[model samples]
Target: MAVTKRVVLHFPRRLVEQPVIYRLVKDYNLEFNILRASITAEPEEEGLLVLQLKGEQEEYDRGVKFLLKSGLKIQSLSQDVTRNEARCTSCGACVTLCPPGAFVVDPKTRQVNFDDEKCVACGLCIKACPPRAMEVHF
Candidate 1:
């Protein structure tokens, strides 16, 4: 099983507007679960912004590289995932569409549960959902 991890990045308020974050998402496909992030200022230490990122291992490493290349400061990093479990109607839509087999339908209850570890964050299941239940977390 792949272990999920969280990475927190701290940056100056000026660096936050550099548009590098978008580039990372577009280029490397960084999956981010934002927990707590904001730009704050103090009397002595102003113009500082904090960003927290939670995602898979690959995303974490790439995000670090993206931040480093952009000249942003790294604050903290930890292993964690803020998962969003969605209800599955068991219409076999997710089963057929989910390439990673992240979704599984219970034979007894007809309910479906999605495993984030197994998921590659593909959006195919989202389109295949008849009830619009499956949501891809980035």
Candidate 2:
């Protein structure tokens, strides 16, 4: 069976410039989709990448092991972002700032819908929301 997972990866300063992501595809037979990344040429700070990985369960596990061995911190995507419907006004303010289109306005009800699966936890929506509805955990 195939498995897909979304995870936040933290790269140590020393490993920030490595070709590990390429290895995940070529060596592990895993597909990598980088949703968001913060990397710099300097090795002064740890870099972060939010990625979606897809492959067989075994291959995914192996790839995760490889990441762990390389001193990368892995975090699950669950609880990364949330929306309070009671506090939301469907103002569509967050729709423009969300890079992944996680927030959408329902055509029929004209209400805003929050899709957690599509959220990359970039935290831009939280500030864009006028009612302060979007909350980011990480």
Candidate 3:
């Protein structure tokens, strides 16, 4: 079965320069879409990467195992951020705060639309929402 999974990867300072992502494609036959990345060239600082990986279920599992063996800390990107429609007032408070533009206003309807797929669970919208419509769930 084919599967796609979003994940967060933590790279230790020592492994930051390695071609870890390349191995996923060449050895594991996985496809990846990078959502966000914060990598520092400094030798003392660690690197962080958020990405969606897609492949067969068996291949995905193998790729994840490779990441673990390479000393990378892995976390599921399952932090679900949702907006309560009843509590939302289309105030557009979260429109500007979202980093990925997950919230957008319909030009004609003047209503806010939430695209959950684009959200990175940054929690900025949750804090900016006046009606407390935005929420994050682990």
**Largest lDDT belongs to which candidate?**
3
Q: How well is each residue in 4-59 modelled by candidate 3, as lDDT tens digits?
A: 88888889988888999999999999999987788888878779888899999999
Candidate structures ordered by TM-score, highest first: 2, 3, 1
List all candidate RMSDs to the true structure. Answer: 9.9, 2.8, 5.0
For residues 50-107, write the lDDT of model 1, one tens digit per residue: 2344455676677678778777766443212222344444667778677768777878
TM-score of 3: 0.66
lDDT (CA) per prediction: 0.56, 0.86, 0.87
Error of 1 at 128 (Å): 44
**Ranking of models by lDDT:** 3, 2, 1
If scored against the real structure, what TM-score would every candidate get?
0.41, 0.77, 0.66
**Model 1: runs farther than 4 Å from truth?**
1-3, 41-60, 79-138
Model 2 global lDDT (CA atoms, 0 to 1): 0.86
Clashing pairs in 3: none
Off by over 4 Å in 3: 42-44, 80-92, 95-118, 121-138
Q: Which parts of model 2 are misplaced by more than 4 Å?
A: 41-44, 84-92, 95-99, 104-111, 122-124
| Best of the two (1, 2) by lDDT | 2
lDDT: worst 10-residue window of model 1: 76-85
